[model samples]
Target: MTTDAGQYDDQGEVPLAGYAALASVLATGVGAYALVARSRGVRLPERLPPWDVVLLGVATYKTSRLLTRDKVTSFVRAPFTRRTGHGEANEVLDEPRGTGVRRAVGDLLCCPFCTSAWAATALMCSYTASPRLTRMVCGGLGAVTVADWLQYAWTWTQRTAGQ
Candidate 1:
């Protein structure tokens, strides 16, 4: 959504809001997708490049997390593993120092790390008020999130970095 000036807020004057919105929506999508993919054990088409996964995860995660809100943040924080003993809610997005988000986003080399990083970034980016972004976030808050993440998982296996 652009401002009264007909300028896309995020395109320049206020990019953070847009970015945050993107992040929030993607977070919901990724979280829901991760949960569903884990349950269905969906398979990817092929192996993606080593860095491709990371790049994709980073790009997607950062894009998703451009927003921030308790509900949205909480939704984005959905845990990959069902093992509750692993950590707390607030801790889900918190990864090793420079390992998950930055590292995952940078090397663009690992799938698991990149996936987790993307989730974290989404949760981190959520912090604003954009109906478009919020609506997008809500849209993915349900099964749609699951579907999107599953798509991402499939995307992961389609990389070609190994060859």
Candidate 2:
């Protein structure tokens, strides 16, 4: 059986790193949701506005920045992860492999895609618990997201035009 570059199942031991991290994140999200629901006596709304979707998208981008940006990640792991290299937007740090849970969490935090799910859940839960504030925050993020995309589009156009 042909295996992918990162796949290790052919070696008789499958890597549990991703699954473990996902499960940990999911479990934590559920617990947080429960806490919020209990404290606020809130339930998921039957429907959300179209604007809310945009808000969620923006929140995801902002959350990804917070999680994966070098400066932010460095601050998060200052006491644990050691500097290993330099990343585009932040200093890259070595995972705390010797410290089991911290290493796993650091891996998750260092990955924007991995952190998106957590951010989404938090934003969604907050929407139910505090719709007004959530929307305000989301609105700010959504506006930025739109502006960023427009900037990228303009830059691409200028580059392609050979100006």
Candidate 3:
């Protein structure tokens, strides 16, 4: 059987092994959650309420953006990413660096869309473990998300008024 690394070796610089490793970690986390829940006799909710879904969605968006782009969090990504430039709203633009796992992690850390899945998974797990706490945390992030949009809207209004 051809390994992912060897198979993708001739296909250019794709980090198949690194991607596999990341996938493994995600799978392990999910599997562990399932096992622990089962062992503890914890029941899965049939479905999340629409309001909860909306709150979680906003929280995921903000959390992913903070992790992937916020300047304040650059230290977390600095080891794996190189600062490319500045982004709007106190965010930084970064490009993945290094090879294999390092580059893969950098890619994940630099792309909000890519990080959203991880963030959502973590948030969902937290919600499952503690609904009240998760809702509080999500509500705070959701509020921040709304405040960010309001800030942008206010800036736009001021710009238009000045014009």
- Best lDDT goes to which candidate? 3
Flag regions of model 1 displaced more than 4 Å. 1-12, 43-163
**Model 1, residue 132: C-alpha shift (Å):** 33
lDDT of 1: 0.41
- Write down the lDDT of every candidate, Cα atoms only: 0.41, 0.71, 0.91
lDDT of each residue in 23-70, candidate 1, tens digit only? 676668867766765577654435445544444344454344322212
- Summarize candidate 3's per-residue lDDT along 71-160 as a digit string, tens digits: 899999999999999978788899999889998899899899999999999999888888899999999999899999999999999999
Off by over 4 Å in 2: 1-22, 35-39, 70-73, 79-99, 150-163
Cα deviation in Å at residue 95, candidate 2? Answer: 6.4
TM-score of each: 0.22, 0.66, 0.92
Which scores better on lDDT, 1 or 2? 2
Compared with the true structure, the alpha-carbon lDDT of candidate 3 equals 0.91
